[model samples]
Target: MNGLFGENLKYDLKASLVVFLVALPLCLGIAVASGAPPMAGLIAGIVGGIVAGSISGSHVAVSGPAAGLTVIVLDSISSLGGFQLFLGAVVAAGLIQLILGLVKAGVLGYYFPHSVIKGMLTAIGLILILKQIPHALGYDKDHIGDMAFEQMDQHNTFTEIYYAFIYNSPGAIPIVLIGLLILFLFEKPKIKTHKLFGIIPGPLWAVIAGILINETYRFWIPGWQLGGDHLVSIPELTSLGDITSLLTFPDFSLIADPNFWLVAFTVAIIASIETLLSVEAGDKLDPYKRITPASRELVAQGTGNMLSGFIGGLPLTVVIVRTTANVSSGARTKMSAIFHGFLLLILVLAIPGLLNKIPLSCLAAVLFLVGYKLANPAIFIKEYKKGFDQFLPFILTVIAILLTDLLVGIGIGMVVGLFFVIKTNFHRSLVVTELNGNYLVKLQKDVSFLNKAPLMKQLSTIPPGSNVVLNAVKARFIDHDIKELLDDFIETAPNKDIEIILEGFSNHVRQKA
Candidate 1:
């Protein structure tokens, strides 16, 4: 343990605290969104940090209860008849994921185009900024981790922002603004080098400052104070007994139920997809540019969910928001993720009251910066310069995700990307070059029916007196359609006074009447 983490311990410790702060509210919010006990979210967060972090190959990704699974879990719990039955489904789902990893199904991530992946990241960035605007203004109707365009609160992303503008909280505005300033100040070179400020990251100070300001409001400016829903709202635990009571084990009797298996299969497929996508996003954001084994990540996530269900917890996945927070915080190793789990455990046990004082607006400011870093205008410009083949898919992905959800948006982008791939291949299959009334039509490799129209067009344009050479030596296979086109062109050559020469095609092309 010392050898792996000793060199990066200091960096990881700071990063861990930042991730813990980011994960805390998200965990609770996702639990509420999933219609499960708040303690379940915390348990999943803890296990993801400790068990998944320990078992996974990723250096900076932090796993926890994912927003993507909220709708599935909420509906599944009711369909399965109870939360205990749902817990059984979660355990079974984990086992299915384990089997998928062993079968190397993780390679599905590799088939996605890079442009689509970038689009997914950029979309999440935009979503973070758009979603947090309401929270920053103290509109707490929607949970913090909800990523879908449409919210369960009957407000879409834009509508929520519109409503926030009208009913903004006065106290939260200043706290968020002040928090942003503090975070910006801490990022300055001189402040970062400060003996004390540099050691502890800026987010901790921002949370602390928010607490002090809110407390001051309570005493002197009661009208502008934030409490209840505006605060962190961690489940209070006064004794060790309170902690044990929250734990709920899975009902093993559900193992024989078909409904249980249906829910388990759905959870396993979705969780694996989310994990694969999140890992792709995480690897892109890592400063070290390290690649993680996708199959191993599946195994790690499976292990975490199994353990979480064995006790009481929500389903777990490699969450993009928390993973982004960890990478943006300069996490150096997996210890940061593991330590963040321990911090969550400690928060629930010893300091729920203290953490509860943190204003949600303050955390909003932190995410705002993370969002800006991701969706910077420069990224758009860079992708646009790559041409329509890349830019089209990238922009489409961002729009699709913004309008729909992550998986659907990515699927749309992939279809567009595949279209471009076929279009490019169609054009490049056969090369046509002309010199001084003579033409060399070279087929480089396989020429399929998709390229037949272009090949015919090129062959038809040869002048009446021109000499044409059809080169097929390099082509390993020519579709029957292409061979027929060549035969027709050859038979008509004498009438136009066009000379036809075929190289390495005597066996394939026959003269036709």
Candidate 2:
């Protein structure tokens, strides 16, 4: 244990604390969005960090309750009758994922296009910035938007800005401005090398500042004070017995229920895809450039969910926001992720009141930086410069996800991307170069049916009284449709008063025509 973590234990400790802070509000927000018990998200966060991190192949991919699965979970709870019954579906989903991992089905994650993944992240970042604006202005809503355009509140995402502008809190605006300033200065080259600011993480100081600012309002400046509704609300645990009571077991009798199987299958597939993409994203951010073992990821996620379900936790997946925060904080090993779990467990039990005093606005500031890093304008420009093929799919993905859901958005992008792929292949199949009043037709080694229309169109443009040369010396495979077209063209050559020439044609092909 020491060998794997001891070399950079200090760095891991710093990163863990930063990640823990960033994850706290998101966990609470996602749980609220899912319509489960508030503690359910916390439980999933702990298990994901401890169990999944312990076994996961990637050093920085952190698992927890995902916002993407919120809609499915919400609907399942209603369809399956209640939260306890829904736990059964989660358990079933985990078992199915275990089977999939055993069969090496995790590689399905690799088939997704890179442009689609980047667009997915970019859309999430834009959503993050847009949604957090309300919290940053202190809207004081119990249910925060969970990184989606179609919010859980049944309102479009733009409504959040309306709420922020109308219901803005005086106390929070200052705290957020101060928090953002602190983060900005902390990142500056001058402040980074300072003796004190360099050692302690910027997030810890931000939390402390938030706490102090709110406390000042609560006591000394009661005239403009903020209420508890505006702060983080972690349920306080008064006794050791309180911890055990939070655990809830699933009703196993639902195993025979067909509806349970349907929900389970849906969750398993969606969770697997989200986890795989997050793992790939984390790998891109790895300074060491190491590839994660994809198969091991499925096993770890299945194990975490099984345990989480048994204990009344929300579904778990690798989350991109926290994963990016982990990278930003300079996490070196999986120990940083595991340690963050332990920190979550300790703090939720030890000082729920202290945590509750933290204003959501400060946390929003932290997330704003993370969001901008993911959706950098420089990246968008670079993608555009690559070519329209890459940029178009990326733009489509971002727009679709911003207006609809994740799966649908990615599907739209993939379809657009596939069209470009087929188009490029069509151009390469057969070449027609005209010279000296004659047309030279050079067929490539392999040609598919997709090229037939283009090939036929080019052949038709051969003006009357012109010569034609057909070359297939390097051809290996030709579709029957293409051969038929060539045969028909050859037989009708006399009608157009055009000469016909065939070079390197197969004897059988020559004889058949």
Candidate 3:
């Protein structure tokens, strides 16, 4: 039991610090993308770690304001007329998620196809690579949030990449190049073998280097020194009282609005699904192979979302990036997750001014590597060899995401995958073989309405005046269409002098006997 709370104290502390560093920029960036105050993202991180981490059944899954929910939050805040009203909707969403957990909706997550998930991850990775080009080149015009393909400032994604070189920050380029070099160098297999280098997480080193370099630039190269727009920005706080003032309470006055309920419902369903998927992914990443309790995870997330809303924060999900960072940094227990929340709380309250000095390009370098890892071409080729059934949906998903957003792209891939599923089932619905002066028809495990066409086609080819054996020994489910087809065949077969022997049709065989 003690082991779970950072039982390996050294490992947990190092991992917690790395996750905190990775999350700081991301939390603020996602909030900015959501059209909420930067502080809202931090608040959600605080609750996600302390509150959600405490109740969640997952040992590794980290909760925080996720980029996936940015569209929903942005739209909700805009349509609701104010941030406070949207907070009310978030609270309602939490309650609805609680009800969903109670009803055991967690199993629904399993319904998502594995290929579709791979496609989703690959698409996100590609998007990250494409979008981070500007930040890497030190063009921070749209640095705070780069989730959408079409920028709110009227610039599209590709143009921003093209403009990055033309308007690149001289100081930022060196910082990014050096930062990326250090990051890549540290990840070498040999460096990982060294005890000293192994203990210092790569992202932490990159951040420290970025901060010192930026400070040095300000000292010597003041003209090209990066400022707030090109750096991480945590609002400086004078005291605990100042932090207290920033907390916005949720306004429950609009809770009665039917329209509000619809928004809440949307949030709850999407959040739950996203949380469940993250939990599954986290459990897979766990070195110990521990299973996460999905329903309980929903409850924990619900509690965190409600607390975040109460404090005027963006909605939280079981965020995959932070969880992956936590895992990669060798987190041993839930304590790392809880400690991350504590760190966010202290960092925001204690040293917001100092944290802001870290260059945004350094963070972009980190995400760039993360994106490359997720969308590795090796993975694409691996799935490609699995044949068209897997590769088609996977590539289509990546292409669709390039054209559209994440959720829409996943939906498109799933729809395509479903067509393949039906097509395969239709082809396998029935089988026919010929024996000594007789015919045999074998029914598969599931014979549904979709199988009707193929089944009839196979049955129609049976030779006239030939004795037939209909086999259903292993058929678990026979839909009405299949049964009616069999009944009509039995009635009309006499016209062709076809004698049929039925197997595994208990009632009909008994009646004839």
Candidate 4:
């Protein structure tokens, strides 16, 4: 047991470090965009890693407050009168998530249509491309926002494209070019020949190269400044006193507001959906093919959110960005996630100066690649071949998410998927046959409330003065509602001059009906 757990621990630590590096800049950037202190993002990241990761069943999944939630968090904070009040909603949301997990609501994740997942991936990729363009060009007017295409219209992404020629920063071009070069080199087969070079990831190499290029440009030409605004700046917090002062508490007084409950419920639902989706993606990327325990993940997320809220941090959930980075970085266990959180804590305390030097554009390039992979055309083609029932809902899900938001899009897709499933079962069960002088009707598998509508329509349309037989030989289960419907059909059959025969009507079937 020790050996097995030990191996996992080692793997997780390695994975966590990689995830920490990837998550650090993102946490700050997202918090900045959400109109909150940068430290709020870091605090959430720490809680998500240590608190959530410790309890989560997922080996590779990483949790944090995501950019996707920024708008909601910001709005809640504004309306609630302060960030502390918003924290109250987050705490409430965490409790709701915990209750949902206990009720085994995670099963909902399994019912999501494949097409919808594909569509979501595509939409997210498109959004990443649009949002990252501004960052790549050194315009930090807004944070990388939602997965919607139209949302981009409201931000600098639209404006920066037109202004690029007129207001382009000279230093940005070199930094972006160097970052791209690093990415190219990492992808090149020739570079793999070198042992030291092959061990490093493309994103890490790009960050290093970006730093070097910025320093080199500054040294050669003192007037050409590229270091300050273009890069990630670690917030100045000198002592333990400073850190203590930063901590915020939830405003329990806000509990009186009905809007608080509404916001809390919305956050819980959306955060759970996002977490479940990320778990699915993380499992896909796991080399061991391990399936994450969904209920435990919700519990972990809940705990993390609770802690984050207590510390005046943002709401937390399983984020795809850091999880993907963890997988790609060869993370093998949950320790990587925990260690990543620890690393975040240690780095913030010890080496804020070093972190402040890294350029944001370099990070943007890394995210750009991630977005591209998520929305690749190959995924669409792959899902399309799964059949119309699969692809249609997936396409609808993608469009819905892009046009509306994640939860609404997924809800629409789920409804469509449920309809298809019910229709398929109904069509399969519907068998009409002439047995001797009687017309025989047979059901396949189980018949439930979903099959009632179609069954009623078929029964009402049956030819008058015809004999009918209802067979249940193939049905393993039937709902009471369906049995009642059958009873109604029997009572009315004689009035229409139709003879009725019921087969395999056991005591159990009668009770069930």
Candidate 5:
């Protein structure tokens, strides 16, 4: 056990660092989007990294405030009358999550269809692509949390694109172009083969290059600017004393408001779903094929959120973006997760000023690449080869997610997949056999209520004055509803002048003659 855990610890450190780098700007951006102090996001990241990572059973999963929850936090704060009150709701949500974890409610995660999950990743990818456009072009009017195109306007994603192009700030163009070029060059397969180049990820390189270009341009041009508004900025903290003062307590007074409960419930449900999905996906990506403990993950998340709420932070979950980064970075253990959290804490305490210099456009470039990889065309080709049963639902899920929001799209795709499953099972069982002018009805094994329609149709077609034999030798368990339907059919068969004989029974019972 020591050797196994030791190996994992080494891998976790490397993976955690990669996740930390990816998470830094995201944490700040999401916090800014929530209309709370920028430090709130950082606090959540720190807590999620340290508190959550330490306890979570998910070895490769990384926890932090998610962009999907920004809108929820914003609404909660507004309705609750203040950010502190919203923190109270978050604490309540955390308690709920803890209860859920203790009760082993995480099993509900299994019911989510695979197609829907794929679709969610694809939809989130598409949203990242859309949301990043303005940042890529250097437009910083909205925070990173603005996901829906409709929220920008009344129309769809295309309309938002048209407006951004017509009204975007030109200064952002140069920085965006440079960032994109850096991303493109780093992704070249030839570069990845080189020993030196392979050591650093494309996102890290793009960010470094972006920082250099911005600093150089500022030095030479004097009055020229690269649109500082399009960059991430850390909240100004002059001293350790100031940082201490920034922490806010949850306002228990808000517990009296019904809206607080509503928001807490919403946060708990969504966070659980997102965390479970991330756990499943992260486990699939693990090289060791290790299964993560889902209920334990909830407890970890709950603990982190509770701490975050008490200390002026947003709710968090096991985010897919950071979890994927952890896996790709060769992370093997929970130690890496814990180390990353410590890193966040150290960075925030030591260098808030330095972190503020990173450009939002550069981060957008990283997310763009991440999004593309998740919804790559290669995945479609791979799924297609698996046959229509797999690809059809997957494609529908992708399309639905892109057209609508995550949950709605997944729900629609699941319904479609379930329909196909039922239809196929029913069609495969309706076979006919003729023996001396009598019909032999052979039902498939494991027939259930889903097969009732086809079974009834077959029973109705039995010829008058012909003997009908019901076969059950090959059958396993039949649903009680189906058994009752067959019994009803036996009673009604004599009225149709058919002599029904039951096979595989002690007595050869016939329909009343």
Candidate 6:
């Protein structure tokens, strides 16, 4: 017990506080964005920090409700007919993820194309900005977390922005503008390095500033006061009984629904991919250079999601944003994660009224910044510079998700990425170049049956009376079809008056031929 709490306690304690502040607004905002009760996000944050932190092999990785999953969660709840039914999907997903971890299937994350994943994130960013614009302008007809282009209120993404201008609230404008200023100020490097500012996150300050400004308007300028739907509303817990009553359980009866299983499988796969990617990024940032066992991480995330779902929380996954903050704050162990969870639990249980005073516009502004970061123009330029092989899938993913839904968009991106891989493979494996009267045919990679046609075509194009060099030194494996093609070419070389120079296929070719 002493050793557990003695060594590195100071550093971990300070880091935990910083991470908790950073996570607080994000948890609430993500819940509001996901159309779940604000407390649900808090529950996931606590479970991720305490349960996942305890079980995961990672020393500093932090888990929570992610912005990436908000779209799926919102869509699933509506399609499943109720939040209770959606919780069942979360539970099932946790079970599937647990089974995957036990069977050592964590390596599946590597199969996903990098371009597709980036595109998915970029799409989510765009959705966040579009959906949050209404809330930021005080047009609260739709749920704060709605991300679909079409709204339940009969307005589309762009039309909603037009409506926002027509019905803009006088009070929300100042609150959001001031909130953004605070957040942006806190993000500045000089202020971020300040001891007080560094310890307290920008979003928290934005929330505080929003609360004070609204209260001030309420007293001084009643005409510009914001209230009701414009403010965050959380179910306050006053006693132990209230706490139990506030916690909800999933509907196990939904297990027979095919849609439930589909949602489950989708959540499991995406959560696992996000978890593996976040943990890998954490390992890269670790000063200790400690490697997190990917399989163990999946198990930890699965356990957290199960508990979170049972208690009516959003699905859980390791979040890179919080994890980066944890590491940068000098966290040395998982104890910091556990401590941050306790802090979140304390905040919701002890002072939900304080959380309720925060304006939705403040949260919207925070999300606006997040969206800009994810869909930054610089990201597009970077991908474009990487060539069309990467940019095509990336842009297609963003377009597909914006046009359709998350799952279908990802599917489209994956198919496009695979097509590029096959097309590039056929064109890039063998190279035929001519210099003066000599021809050099180089094997850039392994020669399989896929390369037979290209190899034959290149060999056929060589002019008569030219010297040809067949270079297979770079190829590790040569298929029988390729070898046959080479032998046939050599047999006909004499007829074409071409001299063949064999560079790397002594064993594969016949001496007589």
Tens-place lDDT per residue, model 5, 181-213, is: 766786687874557876666666777777776
Error of 6 at 260 (Å): 6.3
Per-residue lDDT of model 3, residues 209-310, tens digit only: 888898898679998789958988888866676767889998878777887898899999888877887787677678888888888888888888999999
Could you tell which candidate, 1 or 2, scores higher by lDDT?
A: 1
lDDT of candidate 1 over 55-103, digit per residue (tens): 9999989999998899999999999888888999999999999899988
TM-score for all models, in order of appearance: 0.93, 0.92, 0.94, 0.84, 0.88, 0.81
Between prediction 2 and prediction 3, the one with superior TM-score is 3
- How displaced is residue 13 in candidate 6, in Å? 6.9
Residue pairs that clash (backbone atoms under 3 angstroms), model 6: 33-145
Per residue, candidate 2 scores C-alpha lDDT tens digits across 24-80 of 888888888898888899999999999999989988899999988988999999999
- Cα RMSD to the true fold for all candidates: 2.6, 2.8, 2.2, 4.1, 3.4, 4.4
TM-score of 4: 0.84
Per-candidate total of colliding backbone pairs: 0, 0, 0, 6, 1, 1
Off by over 4 Å in 6: 1-39, 57-62, 66-89, 111-126, 195-199, 250-266, 277-292, 319-340, 398-424, 506-512
Best by TM-score: 3
Q: Which candidate comes out best when scored by lDDT?
A: 1
- lDDT of prediction 3: 0.83
lDDT against true structure, model 2 = 0.84
